[model samples]
Target: MVEDGASYWRRNLLIVWISQFLSLMGFSFSLPFSPFFIRDALGVSADSQVKMYAALATASSALALAVMSPLWGILADRYGRKPMLLRANFAGAIIVALMGMSPNITAFIALRMLQGLFTGTMSAAMTLMACCAPRNRQGLTLGALSAAVYSGDMTGQFIGGLLVEWYGFRQAFLYSGMAIGMSGLLVLLLVREDFQRPAPVIKTAETARNWHFKLGIVLSCLPLYILLMMSAFARSVDGSQFALFVEFLNGGVNEAGAARWTGRAAAAGCIGAMLSGLLIGRLLDYFRPSRVARTAALGAMLAMALIAIVPVHMLGMERVALDIGAFGLYFHDQAAPAVLALVPLRFMMIFFSAGLEPVMNVWLSKITPASQKGIVFGFAVTWRSIGWIFGPLAGGTISMLWGVEAIYVVGPFFFLALVPMIGWVLRKIRSRLES
Candidate 1:
């Protein structure tokens, strides 16, 4: 018989929550401001070139992540999820530090690919929590865990902006790397996992079909995979292009000024995501995960479309000034009309789209057989990587051709497409349950 899922779940969940917070904070410190890094540190300065390179940088990391997530997931299943978490943290610590000292753009992009190959503390933590948490409380536990992600990103962006402004990009990266290393140490010392190996199957002629059996796991959940990928794609189209959009709105006049504002805007979105993570968890506990996800997608779609059409100078946003305190430490300029209009929409889009991954995770965990959890979550990461890959490249292409603002115009179509795909997956899930 399987052991009790709740025996050590609460303690383990708390440890994982704290560790992932540190890990993601380290990530956001450098990544959210990479466009500036590419322009300032790596010496690539043409407006269009910066946008393309930034997208390329993001897509490179995602490509490596797409390639390696499944292998890591399989290893997690075989060894233990905690080990995977430790591995991700420690490896990320080294790679990210190196990114700070990169000699050229090529080296930075290469390290990013390595970053994807080694780090995914979030997936590892989620898989561990899913396996350990009590069945009835999984939604609550996972929701709390998702909150860690957004909260950490929020905290990191808030502080990282100031850190970058105060120190330099290199210092921020070094600091973030140290923080990730600390997360690994926490997991190593605190979290405990009582991993039970899958029971061995009888050796028979069916052995030749091993690959086929694993492929079946993916095929059965193809629709869910598609929904997750599409959702990821929708979010990326906006996010991967945001830093450049900030520069565009401010007319590319000030670097430090743009960085500070970008951080504030990103932090606002994370606030929305943190709220979404918690609220969706509560809603998921009482409602169908699929239904909740659909509602969120609809909200995300509307918000994104509104962002594209909203009046840039409406509601007196120019007069909404920051509270004065740190003279010379912060920018004294008034908020741009476009920037002001987009921030709320950014929060709304993030609030809704942020619900997609966790809701999909909760839904997948519920529907999947226990034995398939590791591989499924791994594949989930892999599929989402496809979105990451296209999202950045697509953003770059749009910004190059039509303009940065046009990226938002095209974002809604992805969400609109996601609606039907999710409904189709829901139908398939119901049919499987009935049968």
Candidate 2:
């Protein structure tokens, strides 16, 4: 009976991972090139205005996510994670599809905000997996899920770019929505939850009086939440501006060429993420989470630095080689080399950077009471949303002021700053364990 139960949960987790992957893949299809869509499709002519609108579009969703994640978490704890996951995926599909049909940038931004308010499939999926997976196997489970995410992201960006080039931006969004909807169907049909709600406490005078104290106890995990936020911020700062940065590097290249290169660079980063996910479980089993996080941060910093300075010409031959090898096609462009160079740097950066979130998830799980897992994970999501909100807006503004390459120059410092915070958080966790 015990073995059967374990098997059931494991099966459910597998389904959850698949659903999350599909949903993320769909969402990513439209995200990386949103700025380009706004600029070219929507007739936003000014470069600075396009940058600003892109930032706002990204931030609008994040802002809504920041506000709604905790509430969703609470609901998940009260109801069930499965329901929340379905809700997020279904609503996300609708909103994203609507975004493609939007007549103006303003409508698109509003749809993105709506998407944020309704969607948090990643967090919900994580919560479901964490709750279902055995504690001893959590690291491996999360790592696998992370790998799925990266795989989906990489595939989506590559395919989405192709779709955008061949069909147009609207078709890409439609396809993205269909993918997410398929995920929702998979979850609704296959995933199962045996969640039991906590019994309501009879409010005695003493218990009622101590509510504030109880809340205080829960709030003590603020440092962990902050750490999660910083980790997210550090990683995502370059994401919103990445396509624009690639466009900048393309110099005189045509828009289609620039989009293809951007997709390729992003795909490289996804490959790194997939590898990191495969490896992180072993690292977590052997090393302290803080040590792993610090190493990742340092590696990311170095990779970012390399990306900032590497000459564009270094990658030309390599790009041509890949084109001929992979597709039996030859393309000639001066900027191709520079864009190709970005792939390795982006890969290295993501390879190291990808480990941080899963490690932190493991760490947070260790310290948080099991009963409060939803709330704690919710808090983490809330803070992560805040980071996402800040990263795109800040990155956009920086790109506007100093140029897109400057975002890469400034990105390394964020990781550098994270190194010490990891130590401090580790010390705090150690002290708590000792106490």
Q: What is the lDDT of residue 301 in candidate 2?
A: 94
Worst 10 residues of 2 by lDDT: 316-325
Cα lDDT, model 1, residue 207:
56
Worst 10-residue lDDT window for candidate 1 reads 311-320
Candidate 1, residue 147: CA error in Å?
1.4
| Candidate 2 lDDT by residue in tens digits, 51-132 | 8999899888989998998888878878888899999999999999888888989998999899989999988888887777
Which residue ranges in model 1 land beyond 4 Å of their true spot?
A: 1-4, 198-212, 311-321, 324-333, 431-435
Candidate 2's error at 283, in angstroms?
2.6
Pairs of colliding residues, candidate 2: 312-338, 316-337
Per-residue error for 161 in candidate 2, Å, reads: 0.9
